[model samples]
Target: MSLTIAVTGMNARADNPGPGLAVARCLKESALAPRVIGFGYEALDPALYHRGFVDRGYLLPYPSHGEDALLARLTELHEREHFDVLIPCLDAEMQSFARLAPTLTGMGIRTFIPNSHQLALRSKDRLPELAAATGISSPRTQAVYQANFFHTCEAQGWRYPLMVKGLFYDAKLAYNADEAVAIFHRIAGEWGVPILAQSWILGEEINLAGVGDGLGGLAGAVMMKKRALTDKGKGWAGISIHDDELLFAAKRFCEVTKWRGGLELEMLRDEQGNLHLIEINPRFPAWIYLSAGVGCNLPDLLVRLALGEQLLPTPPTPAGVLFIRYAEEAIVSLADFENITVLGETLRFGALA
Candidate 1:
């Protein structure tokens, strides 16, 4: 009940909210009721000012700044806050945190995260291989570095109306090479990667949020079907569903990967009832707090795991739970902005150090 934990991905923008705010909200409801520290890259990340969810906020250098700078900033924050655990909620930052796990532990920061290899096995570029290993169907995917690849890809049996993707975010359906080239450059420019060209599948979307105990055991699983979507195709409203087939696929995925921590499996079900693996996200989705609402508190369970506690199998969450995304303003003082922007940190109850 006395643990202080830090969580990242605080940018709770309406169009594309991050998961940290939801994770913090879930933690606040736990019996432990730990002190929540919001860790963010941008100073104005809305969760920083959402005092109801976050007790304090600290600005950290972006993941692109490399581990040294990130470690230095975290070390300083730890010196002042003495947080007991950290739950990173952004996909792009997971690699850096996974690689720095041991170093963070050495500095008395406990984090339960999959290793880099576990993360890599389920990355977008490696989805095909993951499908093969788990005996699941996956759309053909090719990782491309240059737009020119689009010009010659059809020769390799790639078809039109393909999905153009970035390493971290952004997905567009390109009906022709020109569209493919445009999207390729746009995603590459923003996310910086070998752009992905994946065969587009026609189907309804299904999602599963599952927590792994780092030993090929699934702590809990919740399946949902989207009832509404944002313009960008993110789930805007969804309802929990009980699908044994989908749960089997998710269980197999965790078993095959020995995946640790929370992950979301995005899948598509074709008209003929064939299920295809779409994408594997390493961290919890922005809708994660829905797990808490459904009687499975994954973030709190993750904290217990990070603290070396053994876990019992989580019961199946009751189906029919629904969530609709909405927006609200977080009132903040000019002083709160100045402290985080200029000093890179701020305390809500009172100034600390």
Candidate 2:
């Protein structure tokens, strides 16, 4: 029997794409040809309808619905599909899966992911502390509970053109106090309390994606510099680069945190050529499929690790390989939508080809 695997984060909208589609694409191209199941929260997640990449698809309850609801749904799906491993590709859902990792293992569903503590340490608000512990530079930031804090922030040396960020997602640049307060409330309403106020740093963005062996070592590493961005500030086009400084920083971060599973490091490079850690995503980035093009194939390595197979260190990816994101329409009949909306699952014929 083929190895059965389920992957989440299937929303592939142009403005805000998720990492699940790229991960499934990597697994589908593997030599083993594992059976791929696309798990999504919404009925219209593009990956669910993309038959060329996803062999089967299912809809999962939102993470906000609580773990019991999610676990119950997964149990029902597992009885039919018998998935052997699950890879969560979104940051917001990582906490839920981390908490349920033991239960999943009991049900014979293996996952390679960081513990809850490791996830907490890498949150946006705690990133400054992590950087300090690792001797990496980070932008100065403050946590705010109320919008009124913006009135007095000027006295604390926080100037105009600051960044207001939510606890879970979304970041907006605020050029003035009025803008700061407005953006804070907008983010807080969606993602919740203790909004972040960060000093804006001017620099180029660099990203590193890698996997950890659950021990103190790293399994594979790939680095990229974003060449183009979407209107929502997501990297739409990027080029793989083999920079020693980037590799060293990624290795050092894994050493300090001992992070397990896939991780993406967002960094900033100033005019003087100093690198500052900006954010640490506990899971893979939307651009992770680029690893396969450059010769690393991180998602495949993650599957081996989850299955308890020993692996050698992955070689560095070749530099200058480019990945450009584009939008494509999938031809799914009305019956396909009904299957997922009403029954919550669907398996496409001839999907594995």
Cand. 2 TM to true fold: 0.97
Clash tally, candidates in order: 0, 0
lDDT by residue (tens digit), candidate 1, 8-89:
9999988788999999999999987999999988987988777788899899999889999999999999999999899999
Give per-residue lDDT, candidate 1, residue 340: 84
Q: Give the TM-score of candidate 1.
A: 0.97
**Which stretches in model 1 have alpha-carbon errors above 4 Å?**
350-353
Alpha-carbon RMSD, each predicted model: 1.8, 1.7
Best by lDDT: 1
TM-score of each model, in listed order: 0.97, 0.97
Residue 39's lDDT in candidate 1: 93
For residue 26, model 2's alpha carbon misses the true position, in angstroms, by 0.4
Instruction: List, residue by residue over 226-270, the lDDT tens digit for candidate 2.
Output: 999888899899999877887788888888888899999888898
Residue 327 of model 2, lDDT score: 90
